[model samples]
Target: MTPDLFGRHRAVLPDWLALYYEDPLEITHGEGRHVWDAAGNKYLDFFGGILTTMTAHALPEVAKAVGEQAGRILHSSTLYLNRPMVELAERVACLSGIPDARVFFTTSGTEANDTALLLATAYRRSNTILAMRNSYHGRSFSAVGVTGNRGWSPTSLSPLQTLYVHGGVRTRGPYAHLGDREFTDACVDDLKDLLGHTRAPAALIAEPVQGVGGFTSPPDGLYAAFREVLHERGILWIADEVQTGWGRTGEHFWGWQAHGQNGPPDIVTFAKGIGNGMSVGGVVARAEIMNCLDANSISTFGGTQVTMAAGLANLAYLLEHDLQGNARRVGGLLLERLRSVAARVPHVREVRGRGLMIGVELTRPGTDEAAPEAASAVLEEARAGGLLIGKGGGHDTSALRIAPPMSLTVAEAEEGAAILERALRSV
Candidate 1:
């Protein structure tokens, strides 16, 4: 018997494996901050493809680079040196600000984080890793193990000795204990106690802005204290900037910059917008940490000609247009508008985040429990009204995370916020 043209057994696709069904409406094409589905309906793209399309879709320069490079050479083993690969590595290293910093490219953010973890373990000669609870590193086996979320399964190596700290959620009780000086002291003391009790850890990895952890930024002096403790104890710090890199935050090129100088991690992993949705991720390290990798360790598809070309064009596009400044201006406007909505809406628990990476947190209409469902309702209604928004889950309720292209404008920001306001009201 012959199979259907599209495929046989659509049931297998739906039921065979794990799924994240809450994803947004299907998108066919996008330009700037606007996208359309197969039905030709348009929607404002505030989600920016989960913070990967900071430069937007079908960017002419990036497209041209990809096409031109594909016309010439699309496949090349790392055994042979390539022009685009070499130049991209040099450019990334130069922009990253660590003199002598090296770039090891990968196919996705998880691979980059995995590579960073490997180097950290080898450098420290230790298996224990300290990660912040509520932190999201990635979904690879090792990366998932380091990730603080419990719903995500344990890695193949379950006994890897991953230590987690109170990333913003205390296991003991309410987070009200985290607001004051005494609470901060207690958190720090808890961290110190953990470090004292555990074996030496290979690395401490975190997101400068906790992405999946409800878009929360750390407390004042919190990152500084963590850095002091980690450095004092010889634990390597890894900043997983997969969702926060490439000028989305508006303050600086990377989200760690939002934390000021005190948030410099020993190693930084970047993906998402580094190539504006192109499949490219890289690990940049301080000279000391990067030097630990053996020379023969390399992946075949880590840096491809087409991907490198696209990355080069995207980086050039970012610098040429001063998109970072645009993000700051428009992001600030979006924040103000969202804050205004929060003021009027009874369910908004908090309006937190910076620049384009903003979150509209919701609580029960009159209760204290996280309105995770309300947030979902808001997202569903917004989509019905021709706007695209994304949702984040974890500890508290849920948040509608808005991270549009850096090219998004103040006018667009206001319009998107207005649509969100309508969605919230309907919900």
Candidate 2:
């Protein structure tokens, strides 16, 4: 069964669309944190389809909202009044810390990011963009233009001129040996020097935590420090919160909050968790920036009634259950448990990340060499033991990504940890 479907998938889908495992499993359905393949084998889903399943599978609230909205109407153009869309936008605007915030909905993170770039470029009247090293925004031409990760970025031909910045990752770089404060100062100095040599960029877009960069992050307050400098230069700061928004980081509702002393970013882009499994994404910015464009604009499929309903329901559920608090409490324990296990594995080089978005990097014993093969072996072993996870890195694809639903139970976390321990040992 798996072989037949896999063949069909390869024949029809784009070759670049990746599938996991040597023999990929087709997920038939899911409930809670578990999913079953076509063969009826259940596995604990840790990656949550690249962290898109923000809440849980088959959540009653989301299903009911989607069903009821579908029965009424699936879509209505932006020319008409969309109650659900307006209501969801209101809720998000309030949640976003930006002053006098305004929201524009889109169908996916890629489109949301594209819209952000359009606004930033138009407002600043410049095409130059500042992007962090080992960062990924999206796959669209404009978004890809600013991405600094060579593995994910495919082309140099772009509408925007991009300048790469440092300090996204704290453990690996020329300044890796410096103390936290010194490292922050050095990166800020580098930014100042770069700005001196180049034109003023439209905005500096960055992911608070680099998801595809193996969950690497800089020291806290580094961005805030950078913010002070960018503000002096009349540049906009954009926070790419697709992966770190809606309380996934445990310590803060948004990843940008870790560096919030300088106030909110000029623009905030979000997607992944807001609609749970539904297709929803949006950009939030201060009224000045969001209203900068002089021309008419609309998203053909964005803010559709069905997706808006899902977003409203999902937001209410997430807040009602205090999933953010749950993430902090449970994630703290899970991180400790995983670190304990990693301590015994000779090939495990690092265990990092906050909240449920954890990463385990694999390397050759006694060296900093990325052991991509060892990561693959661990992934296969974990899947064979009925656990599903994810893998990513800067370019080598050598880190295990463990991001389960925000509502993960303690028992389930322990179960997954035990399986991961066995898998790492086997590898």
Worst 10 residues of 1 by lDDT: 1-10
- What would the per-residue lDDT of candidate 2 be over residues 1-427, giving only the tens digit for each residue? 3688889999999999988889888899999999999989999999988888988999999999999999999988788899999999999999999999999999889888999999999999999999999898999999899888888888999999999999998888899999999999999999999999999989999999999889989999999999999999889999999999999889999999998999999999999889888889999999999999999988778999999999999889999999999889988999999999999999998999999999999999999898999999999999999999999888598999999999999999999999999999998
TM-score of 2: 0.99
RMSD in angstroms between candidate 1 and the native structure over all alpha carbons? 3.3
Task: Show how many residue pairs clash in every candidate, following the order shown.
Answer: 0, 0
Instruction: Write model 1 residue lDDT over 1-427, tens digit each, in one string.
Output: 1135114334456543332224424468988789987668898988877888878788999999999999999869687898999999998888776657888889899999999999999899998988877777777888888887654545447535798887454222345545556656777788899988888898888887878776776655565677788888788878788988877778888766644455467788998887888889999998878888676676788889999999999999998999988988888988988898888899887788887888777888776577877887888888877778777746443778888888887788888888999998886
Winning model by TM-score: 2
Please give the range of 10 consecutive residues that has the lowest summed lDDT in model 2.
1-10
Using lDDT, give the best candidate's number.
2
